[model samples]
Target: MKEKLYAIYFEPEDWLAFRESRRFNPGDTARTVFPSPFPFYGAIRTMLLKKYDVKLEYHQKPNLSQELLRKIGDESQPGIIKLYGPFVYSESEGKRKHYFPAPKNVYKCENSGYKTMHLFDTKIKLNCFKIGLAWIPEVEGIKEVTESYIELEELRKLQSGQSFVLCHAPNLIEEVKTGIALEESVKRTKEGMLYFLRIYRFKNGGFFMLTDSEETVKEISKIEGVFLGSKQRWCRVKVEQFGGNIFQRIDSKNVAMMLLTPAVYDGGIVPKEGKFDDAIVKAIAATKKTVVSGWDYTSGKPKPIYHAVSPGTVYYLDKFPKDDETVVKQSYYNEFGFGRFVYIPYENLKQCEGGEQNDEQSFLALC
Candidate 1:
């Protein structure tokens, strides 16, 4: 690390107040106690080190809390981060109607009978610290790679349970938006991204996930396997959480399935509408053709109205419309606006429109 007197900023009071309302006193309550958090973390950390050689360089124990306080004192936080502890996703009603869009941090990891809280030892036998995930950015070796680390497609496939989370960086979010992370500023001009220029999938259909760059969105009209979103745009990042996995962090089946490498591209790109459900259905119906994408306008407002690309063509609706189809004027879309559709039918079953049956039930009824 090189150093010249650069810049150092501090936030005094806000740091002290950070834990005000959200603070959990493990000592005070039996229900909220996380007695073995440190040990469990150590066990997990050890396991990761043994299996993947992943090491975390945390701030020194005694002063870590102080460091966290100073850094968070003034800096703005990430947009709409939800912590899925496991239970938060199960509760019904009251601020939980898929409280995803509200941009609030809802913890759902409490379920699975698992609970964890960050700890900062104020004074250590040999050190002083402030410890909590102050800045949990991924690190390769001791060097901090920018978001350019992972390819966007691989990350998205990881979301679909097909690929492994081998490597990812904040930059992947630009030419590629990250699955679990986003930079402070998102690049929206929609440059022709390399991931969008080409398409690939398993012909036999054992398992594979699709990913692309924004350039692919505009170019889908030209690309064969690619599907366009309602507005015909490539996806930002969409996450799918898990309930049971013997694996830690991102659960991947990389060991079982084959991998797809991304093609490299040069130059700029214009935006196109990525594929919609009709397109996906058509692709699936085609047989031997694999499509990877999320449904646009399926959720949200201004429900994306679909007609067949051609009646005979088959496509799949990855995310069908939710019960509450609301149109939101999101600048994310090319000013055309979009509908907030539901991607995971099972999760949104209660809120599915028609209430007649869930996707599975509907499919079953058909059968």
Candidate 2:
């Protein structure tokens, strides 16, 4: 049976603390800006369980009927729920705009213009590093687009191989609070245990998520709010039918696969054997890798750590597979919305005036 898709919006009621996996100690700062998808996975499941009056027992599995178990499965397995985003959205001047991660291959120039990197493959080899195919900028002094999110229309323009400026989302204000750890026995502040914690408050918009599950949609309809991240921060929920098609099909053989969410693979950043169902990966442009770990409510322990390829990473493929669904379906944590991606035409550097390939000299210089 096909799952029903729903676009869910989360409006936060207060500041949110989406902390990283670093350990906190005295005089240490707790960074809390990176929003991982695992929290939403837990929050949605918790909301569903709460809606159905299912009590969660610590260090033990909750008693569930066969029907409920099939909908929201045990700790070891996820049933039918699948998530797709934590994308950004805001309303301005009576218009709502969606935002997504900018592709890493795109760069902003000093003159406020945008330029994309070009794919190059050479016989250059470095010690202990096998340099196969790579994406390199033709000209020097181009800056990377940092902390940038592209508007939906701008993203569409990019997917269509057109020039587009990078769009910045509303400023996220960070609030820092200093506090001392308290002793458990006496409830007194522990000496020399002061720490500063930083949290983020959105200036205008919250987050948007894509979910598909008939049972989840039915249960979520009964609830008005759910706790999002740490401190039980409340967020009002709004559900509607999602009709947007962000992925575009290109007629060219060369295709660019851009990840909408972080993906985990058994063979690290690249898929096993460097192929996506026979579509050979030619090159890749990725941001800094991140480690994903979360607290398991069922077992009262931390979930196993998985190294993930960051969102906005672009994988250049020689051709689009006949079945593109096989790419994301083979990723780890697909039920939690990891490995979501979109296809776009691969744009190459334009040719020089005399029928020579542009950036040929730059590519050779880099080699």
The candidate scoring highest on lDDT is: 2
In the range 273-350, model 1's lDDT, one tens digit per residue, is 222312211111111111112211212212121111111111122232122212111112211111112121001122
TM-score of each: 0.16, 0.82
Local distance difference test scores for all models: 0.19, 0.69
Candidate 1 lands at a TM-score of 0.16
Q: 1-367, model 2: which lDDT tens digit per residue?
A: 1334577888887887653433355643322224677777677778788888998776776788999878866555566666688888886675667888888777767775886666665433333223345455546667767656778888777777777877767745656665466777988866534444446687566788876566566666777888987567998888877655675465555687888888888667777677778886767877676556655667644466556788888887777866766787778877677788877666554456785656666566665
Residue 322 in model 2: lDDT: 66
Q: Which ranges in model 1 have alpha carbons more than 4 Å from their true place?
A: 1-142, 147-153, 161-328, 332-367
